[model samples]
Target: MDNAVRNRAWRMRRKPAGLVQQDDLELVTEAVRALAPGEVLLRLVHVSLDPGQQVYMQSTQELPGGTIWPGDVIRAWGVGEVVESRSDRFPVGSHARDHHGVAGVQEYAILPEAALILVDPEAAPLNAHLNILGMPGLTAHAGLSQIGCLQPGETVVVSGASGAVGAAAGQIARIRGCRVVGLAGGPEKCAHLTGELGFDAALDYRSGRLAADLTLACPDGIDVYFDNTGGEILDICLGQMARKGRIVFCGAIAAYGSGDSRGLTNYLRILTHQVRFEAFAYYDYEPHFASALAELAGWMQAGLLKHREDVAVGLENFVPVFHHLFTSGISGKLVLQVRDGVTR
Candidate 1:
């Protein structure tokens, strides 16, 4: 409705040498104008800042060095509402869950239907689309259900247990009647994972002797491991896996920095134990998106599922929030609240 609109978004100010810090980004307001023909203008309500998105910000060997350009609006999957539209198919006031990482970031934006999935916010919480009903949700379902072959009454372990994807994976495994063990950083998060999220067991990696503790806690051995943290913990899983176990490497938050990517020397156990190690990307499971969302929604509606969120107010908090993730101090999905009325 307005010729010019303002948005607050994080922009890269400098290349991060090691761990990225707040000094690397700037939060500035931008103007938003009406769209071209067939374009729809959107106002971001809830933007999901995931661990993979954090890796995108860094210069990495996995991606081969193309980093987020300075001043480019950060890319992410988010939920927004169309306030103005030139496209008839997506009329004004329609809400959508966008697909592309970044095209525009604003209180108002003009976007294409190809980059967004339209939905009614009344159907679920806006943040749900960024969590249990969005990319992370799909990754958890596809990895556990399809790749991990999670069986009922089986023992399962989830590293990075409190993260967006890991949180969803823990609950889904429990719902499948599997005995779930969540490995996090501190006792508080461990308690939350076990008591609040309904996981059967929660282990703190920060405690002395993580590997030994993991061995003691999982005496039955891990039949399935949804690993988000690699490095030492991954090696421990390899050493302690039950015969014919399955492991899913979703993300490696531990190896994100420190400039070294070491391999697990204990991988020979995989051959002896006949364990299967499979790594997958959510992008590869595109078709399963709807099924995963439907199941997650049903669980939520039935009160058999719950999700928590640590919301950072304003886009300015985006850069600092990444530290909370790596430090393992933060709990639940890390969401950037660009504006109010996120749940409403």
Candidate 2:
């Protein structure tokens, strides 16, 4: 790794509305010099494009030197390998996770020890660390442990059953010995959830008449409802909660694009059902993230957990894979494969 190699990346050309579009991007290729000291050059393996990026594109200027400008490289967390390193903490052949907003998409990028989390192959797949064993798992764990206060034998219902974070929550609920029911968009996804993911029952939200379907699924009443989708779905879940039931709000994918939050007329259900609703934000539980990862790795190794990643090749495909998050159709984790680097 002697001669300097230039890298191409997708730079946000302008702020995006609803979803970040490719047209808002521009590619810039520049030769990066060889590392001097305490620096590691990484070849990005995978890039994560999450639905929350809409917020990043909107208000990046609020942070100190963190503004999302046209010339700035797109920032994201991804697993990469150190091809050349001047620091022992990040040695050659080492794999690390970088927090710098934009790094992947380029064939090569430079990273520092502080920006990485060195990983072992035995722990989990590189992508898994960025996915199920990473933020998605944390989201599920924090929501369940905190907001849901999930109890054994309680009937817990989760929306977006087949997507990455939602699917993870369902599995965790099952492990807790709770009767798990999922609400997803399609029949195929519903079938996969109940048949393979150990969900006791799954309702296809795409079929309409969700209220009736939910009744058939949760005959004992919903004890813990994890509402990932807002709007009418939340309205329905609110009306169906058992007395003293808990509600955890993990995400509002249902309201992201339209920019219109829901107004529920079912406020009376809270008093009648004695329901407790808690909004969940994963960043609030970052201190316990280590414990969450430790448990996730053990579960994965013991074959008690499973994960799926939807990969998009090249930097150009990050937008499309990301759009799947808002779509009611796509399931599993969405990731961008910048280059071949590592697996479990």
- Candidate whose TM-score is highest: 1
Q: Give the TM-score of each candidate.
A: 0.90, 0.88
Which residue pairs in candidate 1 have backbone atoms (N, alpha carbon, C) closer than 3 angstroms, thus clashing?
A: 5-32, 75-101
Model 2 TM-score? Answer: 0.88
Clashing residue pairs in candidate 2 are 74-102, 75-101, 75-102, 76-101, 125-344
Q: Which residue segments of model 2 deviate by more than 4 Å?
A: 1-3, 33-39, 59-70, 99-112, 340-344
Model 1 C-alpha lDDT per residue in residues 30-56, reported as the tens digit of each score: 666657887887778877777665676
lDDT of model 1 at position 242: 93
Candidate 2 lDDT, tens digit per residue, 1-344?
45466777877888876567888877777777778677788777887776556556656466432546666677766777778888889878877776444455566777767666687755667788667877788889899997888899999999977888888999999998999999988788889898778899999887879999889888878999998887888889888999999989877777776676869878798999899988866767877877888888787777767898877677666677667777754567877888543432
Steric clash count of candidate 2: 5
Candidate 1 residue runs with Cα over 4 Å from true position: 1-3, 60-67, 103-105, 340-344
